[model samples]
Target chain A: MFDWLQHFADWLIFTVFNIDAGTKLGTALNFFVYDTIKIMILLFVIVFIMGIVNTYFPIEQLKNYLNKKKLYGLEYVFSAIFGAITPFCSCSSVPLFIGFVQGGIPLGVTFSFLITSPLVNEVAIAMFLGMFGLKATLIYAFSGILLGTIGGWLLGKMNLEPLLSDWVKEILKLKMQQTSYQKEQQTFYQRLPEITRAATDIVKGVLLYVIIGIAIGAIMHGYVPENFFNQYLGGGQWWTVPLAVILAVPMYANAAGIVPVIQVFVAKGVPLGTAIAFMMATVGLSIPEATLLKKVMSLKLITLFFAVVTICIIISGYVFNLLL
Target chain B: MSKVIKVLGTGCPKCKAMTQVVTDVISKHNIDATVEKVEDIIEIMKYNVMTTPALLVDDTICIKGRVPSQDEVFTFLSNNE
Candidate 1:
């Protein structure tokens, strides 16, 4: 992938410090610089493209499509696939979920979208590709999407719409208000400044987190003994998977911020499966997201949702650790 | 004279509430202005706004990260106008 970045970092380190770049400290320093620069460039370029796509992808069409679907497996698949692309925030997805429910989308289909949208997004893809290489990146993306699809399917089969909170049911009865917008046509020529501006905005938002994550990673890279975690973490161990999932569920962060830290974890000999499971849990599930989901779902249903995702993630972590 | 008021957001609830506030202020004053909701993340960034529920009056950033009251929105409009 970005082998050039390593060479560049090596040159910079050797030229500045007059030290052998292959030494332990130099290698860690080079890793930090290479990854930070790579991720920064990736975030800017990918986010810019995503912004443009978001502008052209009409929300109305997606809603209409979800509303019209009647088949079970096909609808779930379509919803999960669409959800995989639509980037989501902890709070933003709630209102959109409300709209979906109000539009008469089935419980399971909507859940599929909500669960998959945040977990399997493009930003994560770019981060994984840059940090974990192609093979691992593909495995991560595939497992994430598959986990969402299967989890949603199983939940839907349970027919638990009655478990929705009373307030959610009441809102469904009321006519959802649609906000109309005056058309604003923009050409590709006009989008140049907009793309740069968006890239800058996104960088500004995540820059601090990214720096902190990378800093922590650099420290770990320098200080941790190689394969220091063999006894504590391995596929052969049963507790490692659940331990990773439990540790990851409470702390939430964007993929851009967390991937740097995960890179260090993998370097520190965290099992590939456990590290990825942690990534999915931290990025996909969070307290704020749970609080928002609570507004529309009963305590029981919320518990069920969390439980399902946790189990799936733990299973993935253990399976990958063994296979890889 | 007319003005263009842009609400920069990702179409979240806070963004929607701010849009409603701006809409109400415009109607109450009967102001001769065009209100546009910039829901596209890319479009919203043209103003260098990092946070949502941002109010931009005629290309100048007014309020960001929170919804201003209708009275506050009125002041923003009147001052800009």
Candidate 2:
């Protein structure tokens, strides 16, 4: 009777979920379910916590503490560390950037957030671990943090304030208007709904993108040709990094969406550097991300952001190729 | 009826420049039009554009994926008008 009940349950689950019984489809379906649940729940939890932090911590205090121009290097390090822990995409990171700026965080420090947010995220880390193992994931994560810190500090030192749009400057000027409304003054209990609302807003905004990204990733995993990478990007030629970056520019997809493609490339014996470059290009500098960034940044700053990220990805890819 | 032109982006400089150029062109031609900037991603995505710095005139996508020169934009506006 127990055996029969088990069989019945299996049949019910298979029919309802359309899960394959025992094949790659089954494996893929299991992976999808596990990954989706893990990602969504993790995202909700982290964002909720961050939202609470945002609400109660008073970015103003943090900003006031770090506002000295000379301490910009330390601010960059802080931003990079925070960025490494928070798994935000380019589009998702903007609101946080606004929060940081409105909170009076330095431009370069906020830039560190922008830089590391998408490039090295928890989702990317998990996927990297699952696909490429722990060593690669650790290296990628560490390097990403380093890059974010250095890039932000360097840009901060350049004093590119002149390149800012008049409107942004205007917005900055108006920052003093709301200095009195401090959310942090509220008790933690009072801030719960605010945290919930912020998390919900973030999830609502980003969930669609995540679904689309995962769907595309699943499709690529199941359908794309194994040897396609070998045919297109397998050469050890020096120009492949730039070529890959150029190819990735016009396309709009996220890191999760491109991981399956990277897996295929690795499986097909593409050089590690070239494949990493392609992944970074597609994930870090997507068209959608650029479009989203256009709302807050000026053209010159946007161009600089793209250039810096692309160069970093290329360098990282080369390093990976040399070492591994 | 005045034509409405919207520059869609995240309020970045190029997006601002695009808005400026469009406004400049409309004013120079004495065309009765309202130029606005759309910074919301969902609203921008409604037009099926994957790139930023896009221009929309009368709710139609006129230029996409690149920042247009002032003359190019004028020609676009005039041709559409």
Relative to the unseen true structure, what is the C-alpha lDDT of residue A287 in candidate 1, on a scale of 0 to 100?
Answer: 82
Tens digit of lDDT per residue, candidate 2, span A16-108?
767776655654454455444545665677677655543334333445565645662577887787777754334345555555665567777
Chain B vs. true chain B: TM-score per candidate: 0.94, 0.88
Error of 2 at A266 (Å): 2.9
Against the true structure, what is each candidate's TM-score? 0.79, 0.58
Cα error, residue A152 of model 2, in Å, equals: 2.1
Candidate RMSDs in Å, in order, are: 7.2, 13.0
Is model 2 an incorrect, acceptable, medium or high docking prediction? incorrect
On lDDT, the leading prediction is 1
Model 1 per-residue lDDT tens digits across residues B1-81: 799888887777668878988999899999888999887543443344334567778877776554566766777788734
lDDT, candidate 1, equals: 0.74
Q: Residue-wise lDDT of candidate 1 within A39-117, one digit each (tens)? A: 8888777777766665455555787887886775877777877777665444456656766777788787788887887
